[model samples]
Target chain A: GAGVSQTPSNKVTEKGKYVELRCDPISGHTALYWYRQSLGQGPEFLIYFQGTGAADDSGLPNDRFFAVRPEGSVSTLKIQRTERGDSAVYLCASSLGGGRRPYEQYFGPGTRLTVT
Target chain B: GQQVMQIPQYQHVQEGEDFTTYCNSSTTLSNIQWYKQRPGGHPVFLIQLVKSGEVKKQKRLTFQFGEAKKNSSLHITATQTTDVGTYFCAGEGGGTSYGKLTFGQGTILTVHP
Candidate 1:
């Protein structure tokens, strides 16, 4: 079975530019989540999706951060007008069933986005 | 607004020494999960504890959930250099706040052989 996978393991872009990070969840996983991890800190929740709709997006820092899971299997995190503070590793995770329980989440290698 | 605080932000131990990290949450958690992330790697799930006052063990690692369900601890006995990494405890949101996990600040463990 394939674990979660993310594209563009490393991305460096100018501040104010737009960047999109993609994630491919594990097969049969219905719960998907995106998180951001800054250096020397823990992961911060960004958004969550169950099926094709986002169930919890309160973790998103601002309006510039948006995510979508169109088909329920893949997700994309879009950052508009990226700021230098947006530099961090973007992590995507997925679990079986909806996110009602604390099921073990499978994490991807992550896309390190650096806003220069 | 839930927060999970982890302590001993950083630790260094001998190859055969023991190590422990504690996680405390501001709110009562429905369940807690532990993850290990190696340097330059992503987090890997280790275990999950759902019952109050429950303890689970995996090899040399022991995980305990507090009776109040607001805290948890992970202890590794006789750790090896391979154990060098960061350990994080994530608390699952209860009530209508499902689908999101509040992760601790994480404890970085360094082991010398």
Candidate 2:
């Protein structure tokens, strides 16, 4: 079976431009997550989706950052008026959700977004 | 908000040496997961510890959960060049945030052969 995957391995855009990063989760995975990682740091939680609804979006930095999993399989992270500080690796992960405890997560290759 | 803190942001060891990284969380965690990421790759799941004061081993790697469920550690014996990468500890709050993970700053390990 194929693992999780993300498109646009690399993206460079102007600081004020809008950008969308896509993620395709593994088949049958009910839980999807989005995280942002800065250089020399750990991944920061951005949002999480169970089915078509976002279970947690508290990690989103601001209103400019939004994500949606319309079909409950693929997710798109949108950034409006991207800033240089938003330059980082955007990672997506998926797992078997709806358990007493959380399950292990399988991560994607990630999309490196560089705001120039 | 929960925060996971890792110790020794960077470590350098010889191929045959031992390496260890510790993680502490601001709040009690239901479970802790370890992940390894190569220099240019994404994170790969290593292990998960759920029980308090639990210990699990995989080959030369050993993972231990704290007695309080708020801390954990990962130790590698006889480090190999293949172990060169960043190690991250992710904590799950286990309540309404069950699927959401709070990750540590990560520990970067470099092994010289």
Candidate 3:
């Protein structure tokens, strides 16, 4: 792909429902990240993956938000029991590597999730 | 979580006027980056600042990083309608996650031509 790609650009769901968002990073980029941005705010870090392992997930608000990059390529963010506060734009970005190397991040179009 | 603060949350300018936005971080940053997001569009990286008191220019856009490494600024000379967009500053501090960035609440620029 020319750039990072996100699935289901927009999703609408009711409170208490479950929702899943997907991200396909650049073909060979080794680092992936997930961020959430509410209206009138900048993107907030959620999690980052280096290959198959989650290098840092401290940014995730709670256990209700979980993300997985099993094969080290495509990643999925699953929200259990969605709430109205979860409404925001979910952005995905990828970088070259995780350690020592300084890499520039390429972002995706982002998935807008709206919980009613 | 680290927080980045940007002043003048909104700026409106007439065509050919100049505009600027300032960003300040609560902590020292290993590196800082600037991004622009047009209305209804995704953010696009404009440039990165690393060294203290660093300055870079991209056409009519100029960016500066404070010697303290805790602040940054982006200036657009002779603003045009094409320059209308929200500018964001993100900080990457040492010891934080390798690829994590704490973004400032962006500054929205509106140019009337």
Best by lDDT: 2
Each prediction's TM-score versus the true structure: 0.98, 0.98, 0.97
Give the C-alpha interface root-mean-square deviation per candidate: 1.1, 1.3, 1.3
CA deviation > 4 Å runs, candidate 3: none
For B10-107, candidate 3 gives per-residue lDDT tens digits of 99999999999999999888889998989888888889898999999999999999999999999999999999999999988778545778899999
Give candidate 3's TM-score: 0.97
lDDT score of residue B53 within candidate 2: 98
Judge candidate 2 at residue A97 and give its lDDT.
83
Q: How well is candidate 1 docked (DockQ)?
A: 0.83
DockQ winner between candidates 1 and 2: 1
Q: Say which prediction, candidate 2 or candidate 3, comes out ahead on lDDT.
A: 2
Instruction: Estimate every model's Cα lDDT from 0 to 1.
Output: 0.93, 0.95, 0.92
Poorly placed runs, candidate 1 (over 4 Å): none
Candidate 1 structure quality by residue, lDDT tens digits, B1-113: 89999998999998999999999999999999999999999999999999999999999999999999999999999999989999999999778677688899899999999
lDDT of 3 at B84: 90
Ranking by DockQ: 1, 2, 3
Pairs of colliding residues, candidate 3: none
DockQ, per model, reads 0.83, 0.79, 0.72
lDDT pick, better of 1 and 3: 1
